[model samples]
Target chain A: MTENNEYAVECEGLGRVYRSRSLLGQSRETVALQDLNLQIPKGTVFGVLGPNGAGKTTTIRILSTLLSATTGTARVLGYDVVKEGREVRKNIGIILGGDRGFYGRLTGKENLRYFAALNHIKPRDTDRIIDDSLAQAGLADQQKTLVEQYSRGMKQRLHVARGLLTDPGVVFMDEPTLGLDPLGAQELRQRIPALVGQGKTVLLTTHYMFEADSLCSRIAIINKGKLVALGTPAEIKRNFSSIGVIELTLNQTRPSLQEELTGLDGVKRATTSADGVYQKLTVHVVAGADLSDKIAEVVGKDHIENMVARDPTLEEAYLEIID
Target chain B: MRNFFVQAYLSYRGLFLWLNWTAYISNVVLRPILMLLMFALVGKFAADSDAAQAYMIGMIGYAIPVILLGGILQSFVYERVFGTISFIYSSPGSRVAVFFSRGVLHFPNSILACALSFLFGWLVLSLDLSTLNWWTMIVSVLLTAAACTAFALFLGNFTMMLGEFFNLYNAAMGLFLAMTGVIIPIASLPWFFGDLANGIPLTHGLVALRGAFAGMDIGAVRDELLLEALVGLGYAIAGIVVYMLVERDARARSSLERSPA
Candidate 1:
């Protein structure tokens, strides 16, 4: 596996253990990544989905050579992440969810220029690279403005620009849509596929299920530093085909409603959504189980207006896998 | 070499241009002068005019290190606070090289601030340049700048490795200003401080600067220059070792996954 260069990234039993100090100086160790194995092929859009602390960022950082795994081996373009870290760094780029990556004091163009220099872009090629990146990020017009003056969305765009300054073969995007308005997130989302079209491998981690469902060619759902499921969206949903989905519209929803619904026999997961007047509840149950009567009994017929039994969605499949 | 200079220039422009000239001058120049003025006043009352002139030169010597210290603190803090450490560390560029590039970038400003401080001293304090040993004065000042910049690079790398310690930097600068013969002659102080002065970079540098301005021969000040150089070398080695250790730990522990900010 270590000898193979066919895959963009390959990890075999990679793990990271962190030791931190408490306020009273008590030492604690945290296992951020367990013995995880993944083989991400070239030019594919891979999505890693997990709740916070599930090791999504750890995996990305390790593969990007920003961090090293304490145990096992990982490789990027067949170069060991720990041993050939500089080579790995040269081949990859990363965009974090947080807005604190660039120098706010510098202009957008200046920031890109600086990163270009760091990347060792030839002096003659620096300006052209900066211009191309700024144009690609849609910041060419505003490139002269200080980054501090740019909006959060604009800065995020600039981040993507800097990430591409090196023209890396693989790009790791960790929750890129984390703190953006709907339109802003949608705009960034629209820009991702273009990278794929250019034959650049992209590894994206997002909490937004729809973002994963829409963008990823392959999605891996992780929980507690373990890979719970890895497959295409259709394949993952098909694997959970035995889990039936029941939707209910009730007059009022209580926080305990999900817990009560999960308590019913054969029900694996339950979630609630509110839309102004109606409270929408979704439950995943075993396909053969008779959940209809119990769901009605739990919600009461007076409170239940509408109910629909259907197949599980990508999100329901994800929840069922994680659960 | 080309990449290094480019990065250095970028670091300089990114940092210094952020603050307007007025703010830069007032903070970097005016504050140090005010501190010097207090010492100058003391020199006038407690000692003769030559001592006063020595105070002026010493005050000028103190300003560059202060600027260098400030620049180091700001650059390291900016990366950590702005969450750019991961971006920089992940780059293909050598981390040590990047650290020095920023340190090098701040050198010119340090030089400029020191030059302005001296100009202010010459005009306001009635300083006479002809009596000074021009060769010794030039050599000492340049060597001091080199030593100070090296020390600042050490601090920058240390902060990068640890991910915090702006307070430590503050304490260090304070100690340098108070105890490095900048405001007080080491010989006049108690034996411990005077002995401790040999270990700090600015001590020998400042001592050599005073000797130069008092028309001391180059041969007479060679020992001080050599000591200053040795201190700078010690800091360079320490900084490199600490930075590499921290970098190794960061890799093993995956600290970048946990945001320092």
Candidate 2:
């Protein structure tokens, strides 16, 4: 058990490698997470941001005691994740998103009652705990409805309610708002701070930069099984303050233009996207470097309709780090 | 105890896909009856009424494993398919409670299947029940169901480990039908098969059941009953052990969410 209560989650040199063997007896190994370290403080919503296959889910799995770390140690709420798994499990709730993790035939309330029993909630307190969780997730009225009949948003809300059944001190949510409508996503996002306000620590993994920027107190961006950046959203953006983005609207796009812009000195990345009759070019460059002359030379000035230069957003910073 | 019953009922209702009245009636009720009728009719045509009566009782014994195995296996398979097995493992719940509760409802379902087979034999085939020792017969059926359920739970671990559901189910069903003296007398078989029958569930239980139908007293089949209960207990303990081993292996392989093929 951890001696410090300030941090709800702590890991040092944590690593995991998956090995598989083919029918022909050839073996291969893939490193899913490598020498990763994180310390999440109590009562905060810490976000983990990464590209696909970037070890986000792997980290969550190790911390929640669903998988063991091959190398180092992880502690959750003062309990070792591997050695004291039951204690860790008792203090944590894991919400894996998607439509698959529920019993479609059972009503939402019945599902909660069943899980409550699995958590060994006192029989006398089961109903009240379930009711409080349902009301918290804003699904109190729809509790009796079969989960198969629920909309995706309702199912996601029910997932939230289920995670709260034990009233765990630490909650791990993986892409909680994935596949939700804008309004539904917003509603779920609004509940995060309320959880933190009640002294619960939340570890969230998401791909949405705007969502992380708005809700997370700190964010870690990992790529290819490595942590590339970690800090507050503003601090992450500020680390790239020396970076600037130039957006240009063109009448037409040519493949050669992208290569030409990327070849320019001080240019980090040049990407093009088609929007209706025009094309949008986003160029990331060093802040002080004057690439206007070189860019104008690559594409004729007459073809340039709109141009704007500004500091990079968190999304742009994440893209640059991932690249 | 509350958790045990709650988990049992919810898992059966949620994970068993054949819970609907129509599917339940067709699969659990009609299918077993059809099997009993077909086998009894074949035996009568092939030999005589005495042979037909033997086949009917054999079918009753066979129904225990058939119903219990499918019911218990389906519960584990659907839990993997629906991706709830990880939650079950990650919870702080007692593993013993969760493990045993899976077979709770299935045990009674198998007993119910046996009773239906016995009823069909008595009413349609004009089988004599007046000579049957009702007490011993009931105990035999209960013991048979318990033993088969325990064996099925033990087999259920392989479905998750091997990642194949129906293939394993078919293999086990074939093994039980052929090796457990379901339709054949162990004495007439080769010596090796007779020894094999001793380890398989439903073999001794069926013998005791037949003895009960012949109006034997409890003392006459006491050894068989004790062996049947011991077999059930052995499988139950083995199932729990194998479940913990599988849980450990799943954590090592990180394959809890990977469903059986």
Candidate 3:
């Protein structure tokens, strides 16, 4: 039972279909996670990246045992999500569905203790465990305050405290920093890495690329119910950058001239703005191909006012995978 | 067994806690006082008689059905509304355990408020309890209390089915003054009024209480008492069945597991 091959999460072709009643009272189905096989190493921060309705929440819910998979197998900490759910729940802490927490009537400290009591943690240890969790979440000073009184940032911090109350081996933080200001988001960004220092694995999902690239050791990008890319953020960016996109704001070149320039050697494609003077174009170059001189030759040097070469970021890499 | 004890303890605690609610206390006192006021006014209008005095003596039993059913019905609706039922469902416990636990939760306050309210009615009307018929009526009170509580299981199930809790509470409450034969015995009424009264579970329980109140012949009253108990139990079972069916559907329909990223 010692930890040789500890995977915090493992899924093989896991999928979920969410059905809702249509306007006509019939059912409509939306595929959430589709045939997704992913593994998160123990003690690593794994980020799931996607746009809205990309199934990030569905995947997290399955891993946390809040939902059953429509098909395929999912295991968390070596326990089957469906069969051994209790064991899975015992070892994992989940902050479900971004900020859907805390009874409005109860104080922050009370809410955490109630969940802890439900988890069957001994009553005598309640105060100590709660204090420790709040301290860890940086909410120790304000533990006594009612949740309804807390600001948005304070509530997010309280949710983190609640998630960490069990000191479980893993935490599934779904949109943990959503609806937060830059300062609060930054502070949370700092706090998450500290959990990794405690050897706790975190499965985080976010639409924000900076959060994924900055916080996660590995990232998975999903779109339309399929996992499109999975690897280190840097590796993803380097691998998928096929076209170099440059925005050339022209002072003199006409629409027809820009169209003609697109057929020039080394100039892969040109797209002009509707007014027809300025255009943003992507050039497909041979690997290691340098076509700056040829591009400059096609669009006369005098005509190009602002030649800005936008280096592709993770967002671009993600778009390339999903597109 | 641990989960069972925990559930039972929570239910027991729930009942005791409900005893502190202002609504429960006010309703318990209000029902009997209003009945007393209605009687004092009506008795003065019509010729006063021992039988009318007996009706006042008997109205105590009316509170039993209201107290017990009110207690059971409201708690079920409230818990469902507060998302407590959802939390209980997600817990690693049997659905039967949670359902039964809720019944246990409403019983204590229902029983206590009922016993106290019946006693308080005796203070207002000053009816002599030496009659064996009255003693039988007391037994009938206890039995009918259980019957009303069981009947409330249906309202609780109905509350879940509609996906709203308090509206059921209000509906149960709104029908209380009319449905239960607290005011007049169904057998005393003529034709369709009697039929409508006989059809309701409250009608049977009220009849049994009234029979106990006046020493109506056992052979004549046995049918109504038996119907009360049987119908109450039947409705309770139906309620549980409805709750169980909806529980399965609710779990299947759950989309709350979504996490925003």
Candidate 4:
């Protein structure tokens, strides 16, 4: 009778409301998530893209059974996240953001062993699993070092090691590359696809649009605690094909120049940025509209240093949707 | 059972593996001896020979419970402050196992503290031990540890539920210390306070331990040991129930990821 057994994770009408009391004794309710729906297919990397307070962490917390939903239901691997929490926990690994979660006094290998024990991984396999995890996280050489002595990137890798100790079928990573350097982030990104290649499902949350576009098989965009769009990266990009984007740089852009360009008949949207020396402008054109004459008529060619027009990237499409 | 021991050992390592040899020695040995000396000096001037003997035995008997229970309570607070409580809660293991695992470190520490304190009092204080019943003392010390551990487990759950209550709980340790009759007789207090002492674990434990240390016959202290064990059982059940309830509430409130504090 289940609707989405083939999916690794499915949630319907998921909502969470936090209650707080003010000094005046008036109760205030903050809705962290509301009427959210999601379905992550098995063995695929699914990305949840959103700004902060957009319910990304709340969704992961609910799916991991670390928090209960106020309305609706969520399931993982055909088991209800709330009703069969233990079963859900058994099949999933979680890595939340921040470096404060682990015991700094423990060694990297020791932390993995502790989590492995807590997860009830077989005793005979504990050593093998820990060694494999440490190696996978690129910490085998430094496994004996205390966690407090590790750099931020090393600790983040240790988080990955801890998450993989159980070999979970599904992994929830909330902003896993949040504080890492570019090289560290690239290395972690390389490891995520391997998990999916092994028939594991990865649910990743990130604010970085490029990361989502390149790493995820499907991307879901959430804004203000609501899902605004859900589709594959190509599909999301294709949705904006009716519009064209133009990049225009000026020696110095005046405030009135941007207003006049925005007021042009064929221009759909105009965004401007001034870098003190040069003004960079992005202009979106409506489909089937010729904006060259309109741009020429609005501002003289002398004001424009360089101008090029092209299709939108995922980031542009995202800004178009959210803005 | 294997998981329990593994967890216990890992947790012990987490709290102590980073310490240097001297810090480790101080933590496990020197600190307890110093505490015993301070108590011995207090007993020397405060009362007559008979009262001083009672004070020495009472302090030595209850030292482990106070030290270990206090440490267990502080570790729970530190777990919340360090943001690891959420990690433990999200694990697939039973909450009971995690609670006991995190609290188990203090178990051996308590036993060692009691032994060192006992030795220090016996040697430096020159207390008469001719009639001491080693078997009964051993049993009483273990029972006292169990009872106090059970009590700390309850407090751990309570402080975990309301994170800010940790400060209040830490400040109340003195109240529990005074009420447990370690340094003062429970009977000397008013009737209400004396009756309240019966509800706290370790009061009867201290009474039974005093009997063992004074070389009283086991028959004379059998009732105290039984009462101590029964109290321990009651708190164990109550502690488990409270833990489950608070854990459920925390899950509902989304407090596990970040404590209310």
What candidate 1 gets wrong by more than 4 Å, as runs, is A240-242, A246-283, A288-310, B15-18, B160-166, B188-195, B216-220, B254-261
Best by DockQ: 2
iRMS, all models: 1.7, 0.8, 4.6, 1.4
Q: Write the per-residue lDDT of candidate 2 for residues B1-261, one digit (tens) a residue.
A: 987899999988988888889988886888788888998998899999888888888888888888888888888777888888888888999988888888999888888888898999999986667679988889988988888888988988887666656888888888877777777888877769888778888988988998988999778999998888889889999999999998988888887767555
DockQ of 1: 0.61
TM-score of chain B of 2: 0.96
Please report, as a residue range, the 10-residue window in candidate 3 chain B with the lowest summed lDDT.
Answer: B252-261
DockQ of each: 0.61, 0.74, 0.17, 0.71
In Å, residue B95's CA in model 2 sits off its true spot by: 1.1
Q: DockQ ranking from best to worst?
A: 2, 4, 1, 3
iRMS of candidate 1, Å: 1.7
In model 2, the number of clashes is 0
Residue B92 lDDT (model 4): 83
Candidate number that wins on lDDT, 1 or 2: 2
TM-score of 1: 0.89
Model 4: CA > 4 A from native: A240-243, A248-256, A266-281, A286-289, A296-308, B15-35, B162-172, B259-261
| Chain A TM-scores of all predicted models | 0.87, 0.88, 0.82, 0.89
Compose the digit string of candidate 1's lDDT tens values, residues A170-267: 99998887767788689778988888888789999998889999999998887888887888988888774468888898997777888888887798
Rate residue A29 of model 4 by lDDT: 94
Tens digits of per-residue lDDT, candidate 4, B1-261, equal 898989877776664332457765775577667766766677777756666677777767666765665566656656666577677777788778877776677777788878887887778787668788888888888888888888887787766655644475545557556887887789888669999898888788889888887787767889998888888888878888887787788788866557444
Q: Which stretches of candidate 2 lie over 4 Å from their true place?
A: A240-242, A246-263, A270-282, A287-309
TM-score of 2: 0.93
Winner on TM-score between 2 and 4 is 2
| Comparison by TM-score, 1 against 2, better one | 2
lDDT for each residue of candidate 1 in B117-188, tens digit (9 for 90 to 100): 777777877666766897787778777877888787778766654566567678878888778988777887
